[model samples]
Target: MESVKAQSYDVHIDELAQAALNQHIAKNDYSKTFVLVDTNTKKYCLPAFEKKFEEPIDSIFEIEPGEENKNIQTCLQVWEQLSNFDGDRKSLLINLGGGVLTDLGGFVASTFKRGIDFINIPTTLLSMVDASIGGKTGVDLGSLKNQIGVINQPQMVLIFPEFLKTLDPRQIKSGYAEMLKHGLIKDKEYWDDLRRENIFEVASSIQKSIAIKNDVVMQDPTEKGLRKILNFGHTLGHAIESYCLENYDKKTLLHGEAIAIGMIMEGFLSHKLTGLSKLCLNEIKETFLQHFEKVDFDTNDMDAILKLLKYDKKNSHGNINFVLLQSIGVALTDIKVPENLFEEAFSYYKE
Candidate 1:
């Protein structure tokens, strides 16, 4: 239940998190208060949110759930609602849900009336550990993931792990993937410790992942350098997510599910390009396969996923940038990957 301070915000956990939120609401003079959620959160999380939130809320806005609803169109709906409710620069937006709602709500608040005050109470494990903590607020452009957004910090973030009880096992494992990513990138002990536990029994341990991510974000708020390392598996993970999303023939991947594949593929790149030891590489691949089902990617899927990589946010001067591992818990950034090796990376994952 300890609080971690970020560059401009504090992440408060569990019971005391509500106290911190009450303190924030008591001190700030918000003209009007709004809460944003998707249909899922509205059904499962809103009651708890209202019970803990002592102040009067001006409005509640609900959007459809899922990755597809995370777009400019959803933002437009929320913005229109805010305008209709007379939300002003002094208004406060409370984002209560998983990554999709929080991401879109933050973007809406950041751009509404030239930005308004907002805070995140991430309801899902994925957002609790990673998405809600980082100031990286944005939404998808078409089927491409997070292609439009801004680095706008929230007033604060409150994590009540109890909200995670509302999640299905698949969603829980989805968030667990990001937690594992944290250990892989920055804490080897964390990685080993996580692999031993039941993914459902590790809610108390999310603070470590949040702290790890916050430490990195503090050092590189705009991703100028060190922050890029946080994206270790995301480059191709996002591409895979986008491809699956647009290809109706395939099942859409949850963020962590796609990254689970991305991590294995990028771990292969690390072995090939960054000198990760063969033992370590096998350990990485084995660990993920133990928890995640290997996705079936044929020649067509691989070709389309590779084509989608050009649009990765990290690319510069026609180079696809990646964060590769020097070893577990250590990362290297901005590495240019060769096109020929892309298929081999997938092959490594398959093996």
Candidate 2:
């Protein structure tokens, strides 16, 4: 028996399919097993994955891949399909895709029959570093992100880096933003390492990122205290993400791209309130700007973006709270900024 790390429910890294299946079956001898995949995973990664399973899967459910498809309607559709297969509490679900699929599949399994077991085999870097490990599961409602959800841990998580071979460059960049956030909030050494390393070389550092997130999550799995560090760039990043998602007709921003911008804006806020050095702030902006495309917004758009920030989940008592920095390695949460300061922060970005 291998020693499974206890940070999450149970995590098996670089494990083969047969070993993963054996471990799962030993835990729960179920009558049926369902493998779930989004369209992209099914087309590219599933065949190789099928070769590793010794037992025939009871069924495979494939949904179209994209953030747009992650919602209640998809969950209902998947539930209807599960019903056709008589999926019950005794059954198991294997989610094989990125965050969208893992999020939706976790929600479906947790809700179906009042909570069934599910395992996450995340194929994308984003899901591997952020979504797959956290017990938080949910589907987006309307314009607000992850508005409806629950926190339910998966039975186990299986990570195989081979799956990333086919991921697009944009997806890779999107996932890297979360990794950078982990470093910024908790480990300055990790942050420096990330800045020095080449982006294409991230696969070599996956375990390091995973360990950081795993440790942070275990410290406060319920998302209190140190866990708030995970939201370092997300406070403003999420508002920017929602703004682009709702108002834009073109390609919506990826989670990492939005956060990259958010990190910059928050860096500005950090300087204003926390005495973060101007030199560090400029470094933060330069790093992200080199890799990500910057979006230009007029004064009116900036006002709308600020309006969206008021609804951020981190807010309390109707005041817009922020996670700003005291220094490069330090972050302060629940910092309230006056509405006038919002315009000043955005103005800092104007060329």
Candidate 3:
């Protein structure tokens, strides 16, 4: 497979990914090389990475896995470790894990010494398709997702689809939701194709998802305009995700799981506010519900989630903005949704 070019780097897939990483390591002379993994990836992915790269890493840093751990405390720990190990501006950080690991690792490398080189070899399906492709890297601010971070590109994104084999069924299903969002916002045919596809046997769809996300990032790296479209379900999805992560009473929702609900709810908003047809709205909600188990939110859950909306990065002038579909393959960005519709959207999701 050919490498997909980003604004500053290339995203290499499958066969091309290994060569890209090996060549990149061979070519760079770094002060130190460190591999960052969460607990799960450290066990499942590190051996494969070592065998493939065949390079002696100066150090390996591991964090606990899950969305809750994506925070300042984790970043601080990694920073101290890096500082103790004498990581300088010339050091290279190889992030080899899922979204939480990659997200936190990228932020740590970007800020150490005012920025250092980092490579993302995303291990799980979610990271493979979305998290590792874009230059956007950050950790959560308490219950808020990505409230603290930077817009720094990786040296290159290396994706090995075989890494998906390390994941359980639930994780793969979680990643698939992001791919569906890609279809809902940009390519309806791709969405239609995904409905019939199997996650256990995968490769082409992973690359296609990468291409969709990379295309958006390349055009608007800073997210001044076009890039906001990538946040299709994220506006409400992130709030719902954060709510679940911190509340022990609620089951912790995976990033995609929360976004699945968000997509359905936002699809409701799109139909009511953006001229999306009723048929398409039902299609969007039903499509997501097929793969993801629906969470029944009580009134309290809705109240907390709505309060969380103000913290969304997309909001401007005290108004929450959304990326809503005009139709299956087209999207509008920076859309301000009325407060009155929030309950209706949630009610629509419940129905």
Candidate 4:
């Protein structure tokens, strides 16, 4: 098993139903074992988990799958289930799904009975590399992203590459965006490698990305400092995502798609504000556009997205702070971004 010890827990990467989970289960004394799954994971991933884990699952909780269902109401339902099943502080909750399931399950476990032990088994590539490793857990509060979440660690995380096979093409592509972001913020060579056609040849790249994130989290787990680099494409990306999800005319954008556009916009802003080279900006734009379709944001869409950015969790005292790239691997954090730049960013994205 390839293990990366992160901020508060260890992430074990190996084939599912192997030795790691069985050994870990033997070591813990939990009152009950609960596996939490979404509608999709229950149908797809649960069987694999059951075959791998020899221990009996005392209970299973299923929630609706998707960003729309990630709300307080779903959390309330989970809480009620845990309560009805007599879950206690010692009880274990194993979250088996993608980012949505892991986020909701971790939040529920952290808040239920003043926090219980939970394990994350992220089924999607996005969750495996980003969501499962970070220990950042929360459901979206309406259109705002991660506005209500606790920075609580999971008991352990299990990542099996086999899960990626079951994912839709778009889901696979969504997770790839995060891996691309990791390279953008930390290693230029890593980014270049990701762009290569034969990039999948390096199976180690997935674990390497997880390691990169783990290194960042170990330094700043609470987003108080260096951890902000992880939000390189997330600031405006999240605002755009929230805007599209809430708006009547626009279709809801996948997290990666929104962030891919965010990266392009931020790359332009980096050139205009942080002195990131024009060459680098164009390269960023081209690379993202190759993988993600350009989002058509008109004047009104831009206005709505900018308004939603005001409620971003990264903002402090009404000032919108952005994490911009100074170079491929160098980042500038907490830059006070003017609202006018947002209009220009929309123009750049449109072009």
TM-score attained by model 3: 0.97
In terms of lDDT, the best-performing candidate is 1
Ranking by TM-score: 1, 3, 4, 2
Name the TM-score of candidate 1: 0.98
1 against 2, candidate with superior TM-score: 1
Candidate 3 per-residue C-alpha lDDT over 1-351 given as tens digits, one digit per residue, 9 for 90 to 100: 878888789989877888888898889988899999888988898998898886789999988988889999999999999999999989999999998888899999999989999999988888888987778899988888898999888999988877888888888888999999889888999988987787666567888888998888888888899888989999999899888988989999888888999999999999998999999999888888888888989999899999998988778878888999999979999788889899999889888
Candidate 2: stretches off by over 4 Å? 1-8, 16-18
Q: After TM-score superposition, what is the CA distance of residue 175 in candidate 1 from its true location, in Å?
A: 1.0
What tens digits encode model 1's per-residue C-alpha lDDT throughout 1-351? 789998888899988888999999899888999999888999999998899989998999999999998999989999999999999999999999899988989999999989999999899899999887778889999987888999899999999988888999889998999999999999999999999988889897888998999999888888899988889999999999999999999998899999999999999999989998889989988988888888899999999999999988778887889999999999999898888899999998887
Question: What is the C-alpha lDDT profile of model 2 across 1-351, one tens digit per residue?
Answer: 232364547666676535866766777788789999988999888897888766679999989887788899999988988889989889999999998899999999999989999988889988988886768788888767787789999988887778888798898888888888777777788888998888877876677777777887887888767677778778778888888888855358988998998888888888988888899889888888888987887877787778887787767688887788888777787778767777777777654
Clashing pairs for predicted structure model 4, backbone only:
17-52
Give all candidates' CA lDDT scores: 0.91, 0.82, 0.89, 0.87
Clashing pairs in 1: none
Worst 10 residues of 2 by lDDT: 1-10
Q: Which residue runs does candidate 4 get wrong by more than 4 Å? A: 198-203
TM-score of each predicted structure versus truth: 0.98, 0.94, 0.97, 0.97
Q: Give residue 304's error in model 4 in angstroms.
A: 0.6
After superposition on all CA atoms, what RMSD does each candidate show versus the true structure? Answer: 0.9, 2.0, 1.1, 1.5
